[model samples]
Target: MSHVNAALTPRARLKIGRLIVEQGWSVARAAERFDVSWPTANRWAQRYRECGPAGMTDRSSRPHHQPTKTPQPTVRKIVHLRWKQRLGPVAIADKVGVAASTVHAVLTRCRLNRLSHVDRATGEPIRRYEHDHPGSMLHVDVKKLGNVPDGGGWRYVGRQQGNKNRSDTSGKAGNSHHNPKMGTAFVHTVIDDCSRVAYAEIHDDETALTAVAVLRNAVAWFAARGVTTERVLSDNGSCYKSHLWRDTCAELGIVHKRTRPYRPQTNGKIERFHRTLAQGWAFRRFYNSETVRRKALPAWLHEYNHHRPHTAIGKIPPISRLTNVPGQYN
Candidate 1:
C-alpha cells in the first residue's frame, strides 16, 4: 500500500512515466503537468526505461544496508533476555549496556514488546487455539463477584455509606455464619471454543452439586441451539475434580479436560468471558440491591449472544456461528 501522504499512486506514477518516456515529454513539462518536482518526474522516467511499469509501485522505505545497526549477537542476547528472563526493555537494556529505546525497537521488530502477548509460564508468544467446530470444545469456569449491598455499593454510593451497609449485612441471620461477610456470587460460565457462544448462571456457591447442575443446564442450552457438547475444559477446582462432576460428564458423554496445574490459560475462554460479564453486566450499572443486579444477567447475556459483535469471531454475534440453526438472526 502507498504511504498516506504519497502524492501519487502506482497508476498515476505509471501515467507520469509513460508521458515522459513513451510520449517524449520534457521532464520539466511532465513535472508541471503532473504537479511533481522535475527530479521526481525524471526519476520515474529513468525507472520506466530501465525496469518498465513494475518500478511504479511503492518500494520499501528500509535502506538496503544498515551499517550502524546493532550486531546480530546483541540482537540474539536481547531476545534471550526477553524469552528466558522475561525482562522488560529497560531491564534488558541495563543488562546489555544499551539504551532502552534501542532495546524497545528491537523487541517491537521481534513482536515481543508486549508482555501480555507472551505466556507467563513459558515466556513464549501465546499460541492461541480454537476448535474447528462450536461443540468440539467448551471452556467452563467460575467467577466470584462481591454481592451488591442494599441501596447500592461503594461504586455509586460514597465509601462511608457503603461501609455502613456492609456492616449491617455482615452479621445478619440466614447468611454464612462461618465467614460472615456480604457474601459472594459464584458466576458459573461456559463458553464455546470456536463460536464463543456462552452460558452462565449466578449461584450462591461454587460447590460440586452446583457446578454439575450448571453443566447440565449449559449442555441442554447448547443442544437446543444444535450444538452437541463433545468436550469440556475447566480448571482443577475442587468442584471440577469431584465425583459428581465426573459422573455428570460421563452421563452427558463429554470428554472432561482439566487445565494443567497453575495454568489457567488452558481454560482462557471462560476466564476472558467472565471479564466481559463483569464489565458489560455486573459492574456496568449501579443497582439498588444484589437481586436487581442478578436480574440484569439474562438480558446482558442475550445481547452478548445475539447482538454484540465479538472481535475474535470476525466481529459478528456468537449466534452467527451456529449457521445450521434456524431463526438465529431472529
Candidate 2:
C-alpha cells in the first residue's frame, strides 16, 4: 500500500511508467501529466524496464544495513536484566555497558519498555485475554477509601482544620469514653470481563453479607441490560470466602473463582477499575462531607456505564455492548 503522503499509488506509478516506457513518452512529459517530478517518473520507468509491475509498489523505508546497531549479545543482556532483575533502561544500560538510549531502543523493539507489560515471574510479555461474550465472566473486588470527614478533609481544607473536623466527628459511643475514628468506605465493584461494564456501590462495611448483597444486585443490574452472570472472579478476601458468598453464588448459578494468593494480576480487571474509580469519582473533587461524596457516586456511575469511554472496549461506553438493553441511546 502507498503511504498517505505518497504522490502516486501503485496503479498510478504503473500508469506513469507505461506512459514513459511503453508509449515512448518523454520523462519530463510523463512527469508533467502525472503531476510528479521528472526524477520520480524516470525512476518508475527504469524500475518497469528492470522488474516490471512489482517494482511499482512502495519499497521498505528501512536501510539494508545498520552498521551502528547494538550487538545481539548486549540486547539479550538488556532483556535479561529487564525480565530477571526488573530494571529500568538506565539500570539495564549500566549493567550491559551500553548507553541508556540504546538500552531504551532495544527494550522498545523487544516490547519491554513498560515494566507492567512484562510478567514478574517470567520476562515474557503479559498475555491478555478476554471472554467471547458479555457476562461470560465478572471481576469483583472492594476498594477501601478513607471516609471524608464532615466540612471536608485535608485534601481541600488545611491540615489543621481537617484534623479538627476529624476530632469533632470522633464521638464517644455508649458507656465507653473511647473515641471512634471515622472509618473506611468500602466501594464494592463488579465489572464484566468482555464488555468492561461495571457496577459499584459505596458501603460502610466489607462483610460477607454486604458482599453477597452487592453481588446479587450486580447480577440483577447486568440482567437488566441483557447480560447473564455466568462466573465471578475475585481475590481471596475474607468476604469472598464466606459461606454466605458461596451460597449466594450457588443460588444465582454463578461459578465463583478466586485469584491465587498474592497474585492480583489474576483478577486484574477489577483491580484496574478500582484505580479508575478512585481517579474519576472518589477523589476527583473535594466534598464538604462524606454524605455529599456518597451522593455523587450514582451520577458518576451513570456517566461511566452509559457515557464514559472504556479503553478496553474500543473506546465506546460499556452500554454499547448490550444491544438488547432498552433506551440505551437515551
Candidate 3:
C-alpha cells in the first residue's frame, strides 16, 4: 500500500508509464511490478499521452485553503511588536489580544523574537541562555582573602588606625612597643554559582562578629542589585560555625550550608573567587605597603563587581547578571 502511494508521485508515475510503453508490458504486469493500482497506472498512461511527462507529476498534499488560521495582519503585528518594541511573545500577545502561544509561533516563524540578553547588573550585552526561568538553584560561598599586595605598589595607601596606644616601627616599633599594626587581613567574600558575581571585603580579623558583619554586608550588596542569596556554603571555620552567623542566616531566612571537614572544594564558588582575586587583583601588580593595599580593596572590589567582565556570565558584570530584588539586604 505504501509503495503504491509512493508510486503515485509525479516522478515515479512518469518513469513507470515510460517503462510500460517502452517495454510493452501489460497494465496488470506493470501495475504489479510498480506496486501501483491498475486504475492509477491506466490514468498515468493516459496522462502521459495527453500532456507528456508533465502530466504525471504529483500535486501538492496541502489543502488549498486554510479556514482556521491566524490572520496575516496579526502575524505581522506579532513580528513588529517583537522586533521594534522588544516585547516577548507573552507580553506582545497581551497587548495585541491574542493567544501567547500563537504570538510565539508567529514570532518564531518570522525569526524576529530571538533577541540577545543583557546583564542587568553590569549593563553588558549577553548571549542567549537556556535557564531563563526562576526556581533554578544558585549557590554561594565565601573565601578568606590571603595577605597580598593590592596593585600598582599601593600596599600602604591608607592610614592604619589601631588602638590609639599601639604603634609600629620598622626598625623595632613605630610608636608602641607592646602591639604592632601589621598583620594579614581576612577577606570576607561570597560568590554566585550561576553568575559568578562575587562580594568580598577585607577585615582586620575573622572573628564570629566580623563574619556576621561581612555576611550582612554581602547580603545588602546583593540585595541592592536584586540578586538573592538562595543558599550560602562555607567552610566549618569557627567564625562560620559561630552563633552570630547562624542567627544572621536565620534572620535573613537563608540556608547556611557547610562543606565537609578538610574539603574546601565542596564550596567551590568562593574558592574559585579566591583564585581569581589572587590572580586578577592581588598579583596583578606590585604593592608598596599594607595600608595602601588595604585602602585599595574597595576600589578593586568595585571593579570586580561592576567593571571587570566575566567570561562565564556571558561576559556581563555581576550586578548586570542578577535578577531578583525582593528586599533590601538590610
Give the candidate number with the greatest lDDT. Answer: 1
lDDT of each: 0.88, 0.87, 0.65
Q: Compose the digit string of candidate 2's lDDT tens values, residues 122-208.
A: 666788889877888999999999888878888888889887777776442323544347788999999999888889888989999
Task: Using TM-score, give the best candidate's number.
Answer: 1
Candidate 1 vs candidate 3, lDDT winner: 1
Alpha-carbon RMSD, each predicted model: 2.9, 3.6, 21.0
Worst 10 residues of 1 by lDDT: 171-180
Q: What C-alpha lDDT does candidate 1 achieve relative to the native structure?
A: 0.88
Better of 2 and 3 by TM-score: 2
In terms of lDDT, the poorest run of 10 residues in model 2 is 171-180
lDDT ranking, high to low: 1, 2, 3
Candidate 1 residues lying further than 4 Å off, grouped into runs, are 1-7, 169-171, 174-180, 324-330
Which segments of model 2 are wrong by more than 4 Å? 1-12, 28-38, 120-123, 170-180, 324-330
Cα lDDT tens digits for candidate 3, 137-161: 2334444443433222223333343
How far out, in Å, is residue 292 in model 1? 0.1
